[model samples]
Target: MNNMIELKNIIKIYNSKKKIKVLNRLSFSFKAGKIYSLVGPSGSGKSTLLNLLSLIDIPTSGNLRISNRNIDFNSKSDNDKIRAKKIGIIYQDNNLLPDFTAMENVYLARLSIEENKKKAMEDAKKLINNLGLSNRSNHLSSELSGGEMQRVSIARALINSPDIILADEPTGSLDTTNAKEVFKILLRLKNKNRLIIFATHNRYFANMADCKIELNSGKIKRATNARIK
Candidate 1:
C-alpha cells in the first residue's frame, strides 16, 4: 500500500513554566483509500496529533512527509498554501462564521484556492446538494441545527477536493441519530485516492473505521482485528 502520510519520530512539547510532552517520538504512516479512527482519552494527545497532521501545528522534533514531500515547518506561508490545496480539516465545533449563511460558509473556503466567485459558488452548491443540505443553504449558521451546521462544515472541507481529511470529533456534539447520519456521510466520501482520519471517543464510530488506533500516554497502538486494507 502507498503511504499517504508518514511521521518519523514525532515529538511535540509545550513549554510554559515547565515542559509538558504530548507526543513522544511517535511514528506512524497512513495509507490512502482508508478511514482511520484515533481513539483515546481526553488528554491522550488525539487533538494534538490531528493538529500536527493537518500542518496547523508543528512537531517539536520530527520529520513529516505527505505524499512523499517533506514538510518544512519553518515555512508558514508554504504550509498554509499546502493546507489550502491538499488538506481539509473538520472541527468538532463546526467552526462556521456566525454572520455567514451556510452557502457562504462553504463557498468561502473554496475562495482560498480559486478567486472566481461564480465558480466557487457553483462547486459549493453541488457539494451542499450532495450532502442533503440544499434546503438549509441560505440559513445562517446560528439558525441551523447542530447536525445541519456540521454538514455544512463537511461540505466546506470537501470543497477543496483535498487528498487528506483530518476530522477532530466530527460528530462529538450531536445526538445519536445525527452522529450516525454524519458518520454515514463521511463513509460515503471514501475513495481510492483519499485518506480520511478522524478522532472520536465513540466506540461505535471507531469500529466503523478501516483501522482503529489507540493513543495512550504519547504512544499509539493498533487495536486487534483492525480492518486495514
Candidate 2:
C-alpha cells in the first residue's frame, strides 16, 4: 500500500515552568484511501498527535515524512509549501473567517496553491455545490448554522485537492442528526482517495471509520478491527 504519511519514533514535549512530555517515541504510517479515527478522552494527546501529523507542530525528536519526503522542521518555507499542497486541516470550531463569505472562505484555500483568482473562484463554486452549500455561498460565517459552517470548512479543506485531511473533532459541536450528515460528506470525500484521519471521542462516529486506534498517555494502543466499508 502507498503511504500518505509516516511517523517514526516521534516525540514531542511541552515546557512552561516544567517540562511535560506529550508524545513518546510514537510511530505510525497512514495509507492512502483509508479513514482512520483517533479515539481517546480529552487531554489524551489526540490533538497534539494530529498537530504533529499535520506539520503544524514539530516533534522534539523523531522523523516525519509525507509522501516519502522527510520534513525538515528547520525549513519553514518548504514546510508551508508541503502543507499547502498536500494537507488539509479542519478544526472543531470551524474556524471560519467571520468577515468572509462562505464562497470566499473556500476559494481562499485554492488561492493558497494557485494565483489564478478566476479559476479559484470557479473551482470553489463547484466544491460548494457538491458539498450542498451553493445556496449559502454568499453568506457570512455568522449567518450559517453549525452544520452548514462545518460543511463549508470541509469544502475549504477539500478544495485544494489535498492528499490528506486531518480533522480535529470535526463533528463535536453538532447534534446527532447533523453529525451524521457531516460524516456522510466526509465518507464521500474519503472515497476519492484522500486519507482521512480524525480525532474524536464519539465511539459511534469512530466506528464508521475503516480503522480505529486509541491514544493514551502519548502512546497509540493496538488498532482493532472495526466497521469497515
Candidate 3:
C-alpha cells in the first residue's frame, strides 16, 4: 500500500491562559486501502490528530506530507485546493445547512471542485440513492432523522470522491441501532484505492476497522493484527 499521509515528529500546542500541549512529537504514516479507528478517552487528541490530517489545523512544528508531497501550510489557496481534491471530512454534528434540502446540501459540496450545477446534481442524486436516501433527498436537515442526516452528510463527504475520508465521532450522537446502521454505511465505503479513518468511543465499531490505534496522553499505540474477525 502507498503511504497516503505521513507525519514526521508533529507537535501541536495551544497557548491560552496556560500553555497546553496536545500532540507531543507524534509521528505516524497512514496508508491507502485500510480503515483505521482511532480509539481514546476524551481529551486524548484523537480529534486533534484528525484535524491535522485533514489540513483543517496546522501542526505547531514538524512536517506533513500527503501523497508523498510536502504540504506548504503558508499557502491558504493551495491547502484549500488540496483539501477539496483529496480530503473528505465528516463531523459529529452532521454540519448540514439547516435551510437547504438534503440533496442541496450534498450537491453544494461539489461546487468547490466542479462548476456545473447539472453535473453536480446528477452525481449527488446517485450518491443519495446509493445510500438509500432517495426518498428523503428533498427534506430539509431539520426534518430528517439523525440517521438520515448522517447519511446525507456522508453523501456530501463523498461528492468529490476524495482520496481520504476523515470522520470524527461520526456516529457519536446516534442511538445504538442508528449508530450501527451508520457504521455499516461507512464500512461499505472502504476500498483499495482510498483511506478511511475515524475516531470512535464505541468499541464494537472501532474493532470493525482494519487497524485499531489507541491514543493516550498525545501518543499513539497501535495494536498488532487488530482487525476483528
**Taking the tens digit of each residue's C-alpha lDDT, what string does model 1 give over 33-110?**
888999998989999999999999999999999999999999999999999998988999999999999999999999
Give the per-residue lDDT of model 2 (tens digit) for 10-78.
988898688878788889998898899999878878999988888888889999988889889999888
lDDT, model 2: 0.89
Residue 189 in model 2: lDDT: 74
Per-residue lDDT for 173 in model 3?
91
What shift in Å separates residue 141 of candidate 1 from its native position after superposition?
A: 1.2
Give the winner by lDDT: 2 or 3.
3
Give the best candidate by TM-score.
Answer: 3
Instruction: Give one digit per residue, the lDDT tens place, for model 3 in 109-193.
Output: 9998889999999999999999999999999988999999999999999999999999999999999899999999999999988
Candidate 3 or 1, higher TM-score:
3
Model 1 poorest ten-residue lDDT run: 220-229
Clashes of 1: 0
In angstroms, how far off is 202's CA in candidate 3?
0.8
List candidate 1 stretches off by more than 4 Å.
223-229
Would you list the C-alpha lDDT of every candidate in the order shown? 0.92, 0.89, 0.91
